[model samples]
Target: MNKVFKYTSIALLGVTLAGCSTVPLTGRKQLSLVSDSQIEQQAAASYKEFLGSSKTKVITGTSNAALVKKVGNNIAAAVNRYLSSQGLANQYNFNWEFNLIQSDEVNAWCMPGGKVAVYSGILPITLNETGLATVMGHEIAHAIAKHSAEQMSNQMLLQTGGQIVGAVTADQSMAVRSGVNLLYGVGGQIGMLKYSRSNESEADRLGLIFMAMAGYNPGEAVKFWERMSNGKASGTPEFLSTHPSDARRISDIQKLIPEAQKYYKK
Candidate 1:
């Protein structure tokens, strides 16, 4: 009787878990135990915390930061317009905000709900509005694709024997601890190197489409990456880590350009 109950429970759990999801643009089916709202809440909190801890440098003068914001908002508008056309507009509750931080880290990211940060450092490599659009589009693509929720779902499935499900719950404390640990592991193992390669490529593909749709030239993507690679050669060892180089990545991006061109407004 006990054995029967245990086996039956496991089977039921497995069946429920089988309803995984596949990301758009890249058909990677993932175990998504978390919801968009949950991810949005988490992202909002973290974004606020990071803003508190990190010094933010707002660009007001006729500087690169101003250019980045202009480009980023254009891309964001395009994304929203596209999502609306696809009948999935409700998926994003975007309150778009772009901030330029005074960091030489050559890094930028978009949190789940359209909070974006571009370091002053990456601007040199980005070079111009078109280059900045490429980077912003890629980061925003990650958010629109709901990668964070997908990652949380993966962790939940692994940790809870498929018992834990959904985004919000009575498991706040547990979820917080687990989420922090999961993010650390994801950043170190997935985001930084090996695992993120596929995600990076997918972002590039979608980013190109988004930027082109926003009226930016898709051709500039190749040159932007080349500049990035030149910078990488001297910076921290992202090569020793993972991610394709300028040449290899540009080749892949070029292959996707024909498809992206279809979405280009000009």
Candidate 2:
């Protein structure tokens, strides 16, 4: 039994090392025990199902919806260009899509693969285009950094070692399908992909740069975050669950602005 445990630990370490990957732009290394394409395919299907469900009211033909798409596309294009320049375009084949959902959720999220949903309730807080860009840029940065995949990978690592090793080695996609299911529900009920505080801070850093790349001023993110901080409440805004709005976060965003300004578009 001792020898068996030792070998299993060795095997797990090997898999962990083999699965290492670096996040784009931030250049942070992450473990990737699951397939990226598989997660994206799942997200696309979940996104379509959510859109088609009767519970989902997809707003369109209005300026708000149009603005969501515009902001999303601009950031996507800028991000794609950056990836291409970095020779990482092939690693990420995201079919970007954006939608505005008619819900008073006061939240927005970007799933794996470039699928984005902006809830109408957050519009008042956003106030204007630059504010909207701040929201979208931050949410999309979560996807670009593959935070979801990293979370799932960390979960996989936490499972019983022998079972996890077998599952990882035998069939990665099938083994992790449950993780996707846990994060998403096809009936227009999205289980929030609540990330760690570290992930949120990283997303903020990347988001500022992304918004700047899309021609929105990175400094505006501070104001948006300030508004969010002032309006913090209990258990209502889904955004706050994963994203804690406070003075420290705002300070961190302020600190990151100088680096992001380097990528500012005219």
Whole-model lDDT values for every prediction: 0.74, 0.83
lDDT of 2 by residue, 1-266 (tens): 33434655686688789899998877888888889999999999999999999999999999999999999999999999998999999988999999999999999999999999999999999999999999999999999999989888866764545364444444446645454333223311222234466788899999999999999999888999889877554554545345544766888899999999999977
TM-score of each: 0.76, 0.81
lDDT of 2 at 110: 96
- What's the distance in Å from true for residue 238, model 2? 16
Give candidate 2's root-mean-square deviation (CA, Å). 8.0
- Pairs with backbone N, CA or C atoms under 3 Å apart (clashes), candidate 2: none
Best by lDDT: 2
- Candidate 1 has its poorest 10 consecutive residues by lDDT at 161-170
Clashes of each: 1, 0
In model 2, which runs have C-alpha deviations exceeding 4 angstroms?
1-12, 162-195, 231-245
Model 2, position 189, has a per-residue lDDT of 27
